[model samples]
Target: MNDFPWLSVLLVLPLLGAITVALLPRGRDALAKQTALGFAAATAVLGIVLAFRFDSGGPRFQFTQSTPWIEAFGVDFALGLDGVALTMVVLSVVLVPLVILASWRDAERSGGTGVPPKRSVKTYFALILALETMMIGVFAATDVFLFYVFFEAMLIPVYFIIGSYGGPQRSYAAVKFLLYSLFGGLVMLVSVLWLFPLSSRKVSEGGLGAATFSFEELSGMTIEPTTAKWLFLGFFLAFAIKAPLVPVHTWLPDLAQQAPPGALVLIVGVLDKVGTYGMLRFCLELFPGAAQWATPVVLGLAVLSIIYGAILAIGQVDLKRLVAYTSVSHFGFIVLGIFGMTYAGQSGAVLYMVNHGFSTAALFLLVGFLIVRRGSARIDAFGGVQKKAPVLAGLFLVAGLSGLSLPGLAPFVSEFMVLTGTFTQYRVAAVLAAVGIVLAAIYILWMYQRTMGGPATEQVSGLSDLSVREKVAVAPVIAVIVVLGFFPQPVLNVINPSVETTQTVLDRPGFRPQITGDVAENGARP
Candidate 1:
C-alpha cells in the first residue's frame, strides 16, 4: 500500500456506495437516493483532490500501482493515471453527481406515481455508481487485460439502465446497444489475446516467455507490419463502433430516443468518447505504420460521418434523436482531429472530448425538460417556449451555440485547432469537414427558432421555468463552457506534453502548407 491508493480508492469508492444503497431497507428510496448522492459527491471531491495533487509536469503516468495477479500468465493488476486519463476521470466524476440530481425526479416519474419506486430507485443509483467504477477503471488500467475487463463491464450497467428504465421501446434499444457493443468487444478481445504471444519474450533472457498484457510492456515492443495492421483493425473496428462512426451508428438515435435523459448523457457524453481515446492511446501509439497506412480510409469515413450525421440531424422529427445525430456529427470532428496526426489536432481532439461532454449534457438535459413538460419529443410539438420558459430557452440556446462551435464558446477553440491542424495534413478532408460546421449552425439555429422563437402554442402555454435544483445542476456546466472558452490554456498545458510524446511515436513529418500563419517553421506548435 503506497501511502495512499488513490486509483484503487477511486475505483472502490463507488462500489462501496452501491453496497450501502443495496443494503437499505424496503421503502427507503429517499434515503437510498441521498446516500447515493453523498457517495457520488464524495467521490467527486476525491477527484478534485487527485486533480490538484497530480503533477502535470512529471511522468506520463502517476499514482501507479502494480502487482502480479497470475504468475503463470505474467498478468498484473496495475493502474495508472496520465493527463488524458485524469481528464476523463474528472469528467466522469463531475457528471455523475449532476446526473444524479437530474434523474431524481425522473426516477419517480418512471414509477407512474409521483413518488420514487423502492427497488428501482435503489437499483438505478447503484448501477450508476457501479458503472462509474468501471468507467474509471477503463481509463486508468495499465494492463490490456484489465482494460478489456473494464470495457466489457461497462456495458452491463448501461444495458440495465436503458432496458429497465427507458420508454416504450426500451427493450429494443437496450438489445440493440448490447448486441452492437458485444460484437465489437469480441472482435477486440481476439486482438487482445493475439498480442500476448507477440509480446512474449525468450525465457532464457530472464523474461516470461508465456505472455504479458501490460500496456507499458507491449508499447515497448515492436510488431511486424502485417501483424500490426491486423491487430490495429481489430482495435480500430471496436472503437469505431463505440465511437459509433457512420454505418455502424444506427443504434445511437434509437437508444437516445428511448433511454432516459440521465443515461443518455453518460452513454453519449462520456462512454462514446472511449472509442476516440482508444484510437489515440492504443491504435496510433502501438501501430504507427498501420495508422498511417489506414489514415486515408479512416479520414474518408470521418468526413462522411460529419456530413451524414449533420444531414440526418437537420431532417430529424424527434428532438432526442436530433441531439443524438448531432453527437454523431461531433464525434466525426473528434475522429478527424485524431487522424490528422499533428500536435494541434490530437490536443484538440482530447479537449473536444471534454467540451463535448459538457455541451451534450446540457443539450440532453434541457431537451429532457422539454419532453417531460410537453409529453412528446417531436419537433412539431413545441412552439414559442421562450414566452413561458425563458430561462430554459436561454440555456438551450447556450448549449446549441456551444455545439455549433460559435466564437467565444468552449468548443470553438478545439474545433478550430482540429481544422487548422488537419488542413496542414489532409487539405481536402479538412475542407469537406468544414461543411459540417455550416450544417451544424443551420440545424441548431433552426431548431431554436422553431421551438423558442415562434408564437406560444397550446403545448407551450403556462409552462414553468427551471427550478432551483435544475439551475444548480446546469449552472456548473454552463460556467465551465464559458470559462474554458476564454481560458483554454490550463487544459492545453496539461494536454501538450502527452500529445508531443504521441507525435514523437508516430514520428512522421506533418505536411506543412507553403503559406503559414501561426505554426512555426518547425511545423510543430501553433
Candidate 2:
C-alpha cells in the first residue's frame, strides 16, 4: 500500500475524469454529471485510504514520485505529500463530489438553460474535475516549476466557471479576478526565474552549473539577504493577493456575490487556501530570514484584515457578501497563527484551514438554499425564517456558531491554539487580534438573529425547509465540524511533527512547553 503510486493516481484520476466527461455525447448531460461525480467520489475514497494508510511517524514527504521532465533545466514531474499537503489533498478531493451534487440544478437557479447547451453541463463538470486536478497537483508538486504549472493552470477553469455560470455581474467579477491573479503570477515568475541560477549546481562533465527547480535543491541553497528579501516580496505579494489580505481582498466580495454557491465552495473552502499554503511551503520554507524580516509588517496587516473584514461583514446588506467578508477576517487569524512561528500556532493554522472550509461551505450552501427559496440574497429581505424553517435555522445557527469559534466547536480548538501560541510570543498583537473574536461573535450572532430569528416575514413564510438533497449535501460538512471539534488530537498528532520540522529548518528559538513540569509531577494522569 505504501509503495503504490497513490499520489500520482490521485492527481491524474480527476484529469482523466475531466477528459472522459468531455468526450461524452452532446445530449448526455446527466451521464456527464454522473461520470464526473463517480470519478470525484472515487478520488475522494482513495484520499481516505491514503489518509488511513499514511505513516504519520514516517518521512515528511510520503509517497513521493519523481521523474525527470526537463532534465536540462532540472525540472521534474514530482509529486509528494507531507501532513499539510495530505490534509489539503483530502479536503480538495472530498469537496468535489459534494459540489457536483449541490450544483445539480444550479443552471436553472441561475436563470440559465436547464437543458444542456453546446457549452453545457458537461463543460461545467469537466471544468470542476480539471480544477480538482490542479488543486491537488499544486499541493503535491515537489518541484517549483511543477507547482507553478499547476498554480497557473487552476485559473483557467475557475475563470470559465465564474464567468459563464454566475450572476449578472459575472464577467466583471471574472475579469477582475483574472487581472489580479495574473499580476501576482507575473511578479512571482520573476522570483521563480531568479532561483534557477541560485539553486543550480555544477553539472557533471564540466559544462556549467545547471539550474534546478526542485524544492529540495532550492531549500538547501544559500540566498543573500538582499536577494532573499526581493524574492520573498515576490512570493508574498502573490500569496497576499490570493489570501486577499485587507486591501487586496476586494475580489472575494464580488466573487461571492456573482458566483454560484457550489463554485464558491471550491473558491472559498479549498482554492483560496492555496495562498496560505504557498506562504508556509515556499515563503517560509525557502526564505526563512526574509520571513523573520517581514514578520512585523505581516502581523500588522493580519490584524488589520481581522478588524476590517469583521466590521465590513457586520455592515453587509447581502448575505453572500457577508460570508465573504467574514472569510477575510478568518483568514487573518490563519495568517496570524502561521506567522506566530510557534508549534501550536502553526499546527492550529493548519487545523484552522481545514475547519474554516467546512464551516464556511455549510454557510454558503445553506444560504444558497435560502436564496433559491426567496429569490434574493439580501439580509433586509429575510426575517423570522426560523418560524417557517426551523431545521434550516438550526443548521445555520450551528454553522454560525462554528464560524464564531464557539466552545466545543471545531473552529474553537484551532482558534484557541492560535491565540495561545500568539500570546506567548507577541502579546500586544495577540491582544488586539483577540478583538476579532469579539467582533466575530457580533457578526455571526447578529447575522443569525437578523436572517433566521424574529417574526416570520412575508418573503420567508411560504419558504420550505431543506430538501433531502440539500440535507445530504450539508450533513457531511456539519458532522465533520462537530466530530473534529472533540477529536482534534488525531489531526494535531499528524500536524505537530511537520510544524516542528519547519521550525527546526527555520531555526526559530522559542519557549519550552509550560505543561512539561506539571505533566511530569502528575505522572501522566489527566
Candidate 3:
C-alpha cells in the first residue's frame, strides 16, 4: 500500500454514506441527498490531489497495495492505480457528484408510473453509492479475480435501477441487458479459470502465488500463441457485450429509452467505458500475443459497427435512441485506433474516450431536459426550439459539433491522430471509417437542423429556456472539451508513456500488433 490509503478511502466513502443514509429517518430525504453529494465531492477532491501527486515518469502502476483474501485458491484483495486507470478514477469521481447534483431537484420525485413506492430513499441512494464503489474498484483492482468480482457485482444495482424506475418497457429492456451481459460474463469466467493455471506455472513451482492475479506479474510473463488466442476471446466477448459493439448492440437503444434520464447518462457516458478499459487493461497487457493475433478480425468488426451504427442513426425518429446509436459509431473510431497498432492511434483512442465522455454526457442530459418539457423523445416533437430556448439550442450545438469532431474541439486532434495512424496500417479500414465520419456530420447536423431551426411547434413554443443551475451543471463539461483541444499536451504527457509501455509488451517476439511509431519519433507524417 502507498503511505496513504487514499484509494481505499475514496472507494469506501460512498459505500459508508449509503449505510449512514439507511440509518436516517424517512423525512430526512434532503439530508440523505446532501450526504451523498458530500461524499462524492470529497472523493472528487481526493482524485484531484492524487492526480497531482502522481509522478508522470514512474512505472505503469502506482499507489499499490495487496493483502491476502483467499490464500487456498491463490486470490488476494489487491488494489493499485495506473495512469490509465487513475484518469478514469478522476473522471468517475467528478462525474458522480455532479450526477447527484443534477438529480438533486428531483429528489424523492416519484417514478414515471403511478404506483406505490417499492423502494425507500435510503435504498435508492445506497444503490447509487454502491455502484460508485464498484465502478472505482473495477478500474483500480490489479488482481484479475478481484477485477472480475467488482465487474460482476456492478450489474445488480444497475439492473434494479432500470427495471424499477425506468419507463414503460423497463422490464423488457432490463431482461435483454441481463441476457447479453450474462453470456459475456460466463465466457470471461471460463477464460479466467484457464489463465490461473498457466499463470501459476510461470510464477511458482506449479502453484499459484499469493500475488498471482497482480497485473505486473502476469504482464511480465508470456503465453503460447494458440492458448493466447483462446484467452483473448474470453475478454473480447465480455468487452464487446459491454461496449455493445455492432450486431450485439441491439440492447443499448432500447435500454436508453426505457431508463431514467440520469441513469441513462451515467450508464452510457461513464459505465460503458469499463468495457473499453478492460480491453486496454487485460486483453492488451495480459494477452499481448493474443491481441495481435486477433487484431484483424476485430478491426473488421469495428468498421462494420461504424458504418452500421451511423446508417441506423440517420433513420431514427426517436431522439434519445438516435443519440444512443451515435455511441456505437463513435466507439468504432476507438477500436480502429487500438487495432491500428500505432502510438498515435492508441493515444488518440485514449483521448477520444475522454472527449466522448464529456460530449455524450452533455447530449444525454440536455435531451433529458427536453423530454421533461415535451413529454416525448420524437425528433419531430421538437421544432424550432431555438426560438423559445436559445441557450438550450446553443448548448446542443456545442455538444453536436463536438460529436462531429469539428476542428478546434478536443475530438479533432484525437480523430486526426487516429485516422493518420490507421492510414499506415489498416488503410482500407481507415478509408471506410472516414465514410463513417462523414455520416457523423450528416446525422448530427441534420438532427440539429430539424429540431432547432424549423417553425416552433405550437406546444413547445412556450417551453422555458435553460435554468441557471442547468447551465452551471453543463458549462464545465463544455469548457473542458474546448480547453483540451488547445492544450492536449497535459493529457498526452500522461497518455504517451503509458501507451509506449503497452506497445513494448505487444512487440515481444512471435507476436505482431501491426504497430507503427517511427513517424512520431522521426517527426514525419504521424
Give lDDT: candidate 2, residue 162.
84
Residue 410 displacement (Å), model 1: 0.6
As for model 2, its CA RMSD to the true structure in angstroms is: 4.0
Ranking by lDDT: 1, 2, 3
Q: RMSD, each candidate, Å?
A: 2.9, 4.0, 2.6
| Alpha-carbon lDDT of model 1 | 0.86
Query: Residue 248 lDDT in model 1?
Result: 89
lDDT of each: 0.86, 0.86, 0.80
lDDT over C-alpha atoms for residue 75 of model 1: 77
Model 1 / residue 321 / CA error / Å: 0.6
> Residues 1-526, candidate 1, lDDT per residue (tens digit)?
2368999999899889989987888578899889999999999999889988888899988899988987676778899988888888999999999988877766656422122233367888888899889889999998988888899999999898878877778789999999999999999999998887776643334454446888876776667889989999999999999998998899999999888888788889899988998999999887888898898899999999999999999999888899999999999999999998877889999999999999999998888888778767888888899999999999999999999999898999999999988887778999999999999999999999989998999988878899888888888888899999999988887777878878787874432223354444555552
Candidate 1 pairs with clashing backbones: none
lDDT per residue (tens digit) for residues 1-526 in model 2? 4478989899889999999999999878789989999999999999999988778899988889999999977889998888998888888998899888878767545522122222577888999999999999999999998988888889999899888888878889999999999899889989998887776533442334566787876776667889999999999998998887888999999988988888898999999999999998899888888888888899999999999999999999999999999999999999999888777788899999999989899898888888878777889889999999999999999999999999888999999988877776676788999999999999999999999988998888798998888889889999999999899988877777778777776773321222345434765311
lDDT of candidate 3 over 1-526, digit per residue (tens): 3788877888888888778777888877778888887887887888888888887798677888788898865777888887778877877777777677665543244232222334666666666777888888998999888998888888888887777766678789889988888888889999888877787676565433433766777777677778888989998999988986887888899988777666666788778888878887789988888887788888898899889999899999988889889999888888888877777888888888778888888787788777767767788888899999999999999999988899988888888888888887778899989998899999999999988988788978789998877787778778988998888888888777888888787677766533347644665432
Q: Is candidate 2 or candidate 3 better by TM-score?
A: 3
